[model samples]
Target: MQLDTIKSPGGSGSEELVPSRYAVRVGDIEVLVVSDGVLPLPTQMLGHNADPAVRSAWLKEMFLPQKAFDWALNAVLVRSGDKTILIDAGLGSDPDLHLPRAGQLINRLQATGIDLTSVTDVVLTHMHMDHVGGLLVEGVKDRLRPDLQIHVAAAEVKFWEAPDFSHTAMPPGFPDALRAAAKQFTKVYHNHLRQFDEEHEVAPGVVVRRTGGHTPGHSVVRVASGGEALTFAGDAVFAVGFEQPDWYNGFEHDPEEAARVRIRLLRELAGTGEMLVATHLPFPSVGHVAVDGDHFRWVPVFWDY
Candidate 1:
């Protein structure tokens, strides 16, 4: 409940939280990449069989650790003139995910000099726990929900915020933990969510693109400016899965749709060369998807901020 100072295993500084910054101008608009925290994951869970995969050779070639994975929870801040928007809230106070850093969006938000209340909107790509977890301030309520309009895909509304989701779902392999991870998504923020249709505009310079499958209402945001574009691909594709974008996550409510969406998104990314940002990609989750023979590769857009 206190400001956690989970140092990035090897970061040097007294700053408990260090953010990855991506500064780009979109037709005169400024966009910044703010991250919540990184999840120290095991690489094998991300590989074809959780590490030591075929690329295990390449990882060794680069002299990187083969032991595990550290995924970043990225939240983008778009500031055009005086309008400010957050792409997705981070994992807030979820104990089970062991996500002390996972929900640091609020702090990252502060680091970016943006106030949560003044945030014109909090655009959610899906209802996944990590993505929607930071919707609320850790232990505060009225202080956090008053002025924000949460934008979620309509289908996402019926799914996560619906009774069926809580009812039909089985006892999560780990309930209390999963629930802790998911509870941050509980509030409706005014009991009114701005659900959108396909190709909706989240804000000026921010366009919503439907790329469902991961979550029924899963969507991505296309931000274009100064002849440059970035797509907050959301969870349409994950780390290891991006290598095999065709494979769906274990919990896709609709596996077939997830696969279809994966292929379609990969095709678009490959064709247009738009940068992809994943909420759950390897830390700093920004990358370019390129065609490699019969598969796709994630060329991580590395950063130093």
Candidate 2:
């Protein structure tokens, strides 16, 4: 796929496909934010119940492009103690996934001067292809080491592996093939895969919080140290969801419950002042959420120098 010269509607850039990475320190641990790539999704297809006029008006008010919104595939790399942890593996380097503008994760990681083999853990936010695709390089068997343990929510794994689960509807943005491939990928790494239930700490200062609704087992990673905390909001919040936390997305496995979880999470984040590290927000997806009367506002973090 060819790179376009389109400016970002998400306020992150003036050009498409500019590689980005940002780093933040939480006490002694370092959380590095990197992009797999950007996904341009049509605005109309997002908020299923939102009136077109209202959606358009919201975009206009925010100065966002009316046609499509650029969603970044942001993943976090955490270095703590002696372990090197990756929050979400990105859309791997593959063209067939139809993510024409994405799949730059491997190169981005290499650019950071971090060895692939040094990666001790990979914690998946969910089963979505864009989030888990970088777990392996396409057709490269030796790229990832055998000791790298893959962590996922047990409920998420069970839902996907169920016999009839795929027969049902999936989130709008997810392709059936991609979901099937994700399941197959887990099967291949069954021995190395570790599934957890509820909230638990998998690494020092790194904990996984079960925030379902987006997916059956969708969850977020919370990294806290000292008095500072950062939560990888996962798909709990995205795009218009920032302004309309109650507005459900077409990609939600359970729309109603998703909205509830989103609103609940937003309120908690706003009250506690925990930095929200979103996966689909603009690039360098680190920011804070503020409660604005009946709604919420996303305040992107200042670029760390």
Candidate 3:
């Protein structure tokens, strides 16, 4: 395949298949952006800021009524040649998060005509269950099948698999069920795979680059073919501050390191004018980053269908 980009559907922030199903293609690669679901955030999740009343009013002005912030989880699926690579699973919403859409990743996969049995690789950007929630099904507690090469950063694996990790101390932002589900896969994933290097190749041109910061060993997957490239940025730069291009992620283990990597990543993306795919960049989250004056601005490219 020379190179092809197909737009699917339903993604609000990216470009893909349809208004309901999200998918895009570049040359021999077919990347599907599927939504786990959406959530509403309160001022606390926004960050410790100014007056609550003032902020709440400001949020209302911005159309964020009900004093909530809404977010969506879009998992990426890259199919090239005979391999199917899943990048981060949607948040395991279920009873853990008291939400129901978290486990729709597999459903979305099947809807895209990609079979879970054929997915040879399950790549994790970090230890956050939302990013790796779909590795196992909702009810198949012990009947897990479809052998896979689960790739993770050694540091991330160690962090999640750490025996001393306080499960009860998991951030309130994440669902409790998600944490429990993660524990289940601890032994299983350890038996199958471990951490990856700074630059590890998964598929032909698909490479996992160490852009650690969000987590100690967090990484971003870069897909390049026929001179066309796209990066799957997981939680590095959320939408609000990403437009600023300089604001540090509140959740990053090391904000300074995260900012530095974001700068380098943006500079590279802008230089190449390659497509950028992000987990939190909005639906159909495919776009380009450009240097604007002294700052960088993310440009969402629309598919002309």
Candidate 4:
């Protein structure tokens, strides 16, 4: 059967065969998960600390490629009361990285009818390129409101000043690229930052709390209202995290602490049964956590058309 196609509203003349955005409602707050495309990275990055044999076995069990696979990149748009909050800007554009497909957040947002100026605030989970690069995209800053507030953890802002990569196990060029992006982002937008100590509410029922594992200032945002809740877990959790909570993702600045943070967050979500959405999970990455023996389980919610 031939696939149907929709023209992107961004007027790039590009066509998408599948939807790139999904919306979920938590009480009165509106959350829209937008796909920023995908990043195909080496499988070793999944768990640099894991035994290669074990990691390969798990990959084979999941029917994924042994070498590398696409990791979904997601960013969220939220509307609470009169405030419009953006969570993570997505990888904007880095031709040197040769990741042509991963920086589509800006175009995708435009296609969704979301104006940059309309975004009253941007809540960053961390300063990773994928999380803040979109704002650095040419014309992005100019399009945003001059008074726009960018909320991020004070610790996170401080860490990038002299970031360390001693514990991380990433691809050769990653460290330098990450440093350059973080530094450039801070330099360009320092005046707009609204640094918080630990937790800050960007809007009613929308709170960002630092978790301090993925990075010294990494954070997660929770949207809670009317007894319903959902958390955008940033880099704290990944698809493999539920099954291998102790494994260390290469992108984590503090792999050991990142593992602990993942375990703690997973356990908490499993107990609370709140919905979970993450940056690297599959598109629409809206799911619930379930306890599975000694580990945990990912229970993706049924698609709500």
Question: What digit string (tens of lDDT, one per residue) describes model 3 on residues 18-103?
Answer: 35345676766877777776655553444333355655664566476545555667778788776778788776544545656346
- Model 1 scores a TM of 0.78
Error of 3 at 55 (Å): 7.3
Return the clash pairs for model 4, or none.
none
Model 4: lDDT equals 0.92
- Candidate 2 per-residue C-alpha lDDT over 1-305 given as tens digits, one digit per residue, 9 for 90 to 100: 00122122233232335546777888777888888788777776457678888988988997888887777788888877877888887877555546666777776666555667878888888887777777656643377778888888898888776523332244353566566657867867788888888887878899988888888789999999988999998888886786777666756777788899999999999999989988888878788999898999889887755
TM-score per candidate, chains pooled: 0.78, 0.88, 0.81, 0.96
Best by lDDT: 4
After superposition of all CA atoms, the RMSD between model 1 and the true structure is 5.7
Off by over 4 Å in 1: 1-19, 42-44, 47-68, 139-145, 161-190, 302-305
Writing each residue's lDDT as its tens digit, candidate 1 over 1-305 gives 01122123232332554445455445665666667777665444343323346557645755656866567678787765556777887777655445565677776655545556667777888776667767655553444546566777777766654323321122244334434444445554536478877768767778876666766688988888777788887777776565566543444556567767877888788888977877777556667889888788888765534
Model 2 lDDT, residue 19, Cα: 47
| Ranking, TM-score, top scorer first | 4, 2, 3, 1
Superposition TM-score, candidate 2 onto the true structure: 0.88
Q: What is the C-alpha lDDT of each candidate?
A: 0.64, 0.76, 0.66, 0.92
Sort by lDDT, top down from the best: 4, 2, 3, 1
- Candidate 1 backbone collisions, by pair: 26-225, 27-226, 41-69, 43-68, 44-50, 44-51, 91-103
Question: Pairing residues by index, what is the TM-score of model 3?
Answer: 0.81
Estimate the Cα RMSD of every predicted model relative to the unseen true structure: 5.7, 6.1, 5.0, 3.7
